[model samples]
Target: MPLLNGDEEISGVLRKYRNIAVVGISDKPDRDSYRVASYLREHGYSIIPVNPTLKEWNGIRAYPSLSSIPGDLKVEVVDIFRKPEAVTEVVREGLQLKPRVFWMQEGVVNREAADLAVQNGVDVVMDRCMMKEHRRLLGGK
Candidate 1:
């Protein structure tokens, strides 16, 4: 199926999937990745930051990669912050983790990656910010 907008389906996925593995999260507070992660964390969703370069952010232990996260960590969504060219690899890794959803941030879209995710039975959202969607749909701020 082609990528869908933030309608009922998208909102349902987000509402149903609570834990999120935030790939490409930055240490800098000014970055979109950081803000998104913070928003998710504050809004009661478990935020697991995936970045090889950081050990921790905002008191949360950061995993180097999705595979490195402890097996017990329940990841419902993989919210990606990387570029379009880099999304496929992240999506591939996300598939291994078996998250229910794969979300590419605004300005990041990869048809191949999105297709791979859908083929694996994972819901895909592209070119949209998870934070914005959460605030819009879930009344999160």
Candidate 2:
């Protein structure tokens, strides 16, 4: 059976998982990564920033990598914002944490990485905007 599609499925994912770790999150307020992360956080979801350069972002302490996140902290979703070519590496790192979901933001799709995540029993959502989906599914509550 294939994974569910459409707003229902995407909405289900957003509701099911709240601890979202945004990989390649940018510090710039104008960046989509930052905006998405901020939106998710405002919606009562825990936001974990994964960036090598910054020590912190949006008031949350950022980890240099996915693996660097505290062991006790189990991330539910890995929201990737890197380019397509860089997604594979980001997904590889996310695998170490064994997250429940792997979400590649809009315009970012990596078949190899998606397959790998699926093989590891993780739900994959690729080429979709997390913020848009959330608003659409939940009626922007």
User: What is the alpha-carbon lDDT of model 1 when measured against the actual structure?
Assistant: 0.88
Instruction: Estimate candidate 2's alpha-carbon lDDT, on a 0 to 1 scale.
Output: 0.87
Estimate TM-scores for all models: 0.94, 0.94
Query: Per-residue alpha-carbon lDDT of model 2 for 29-135, expressed as tens digits?
Result: 99999999999898999999999999999788999999899988889999999989998888788888888889989998888988888877888888999999988
Q: Which stretches in model 2 have alpha-carbon errors above 4 Å? A: 1-4
What TM-score, to 2 decimals, does candidate 2 have?
A: 0.94
**Clash count list over all predictions:** 0, 0
Q: How does model 1 score by TM-score?
A: 0.94
Give each model's whole-structure lDDT: 0.88, 0.87
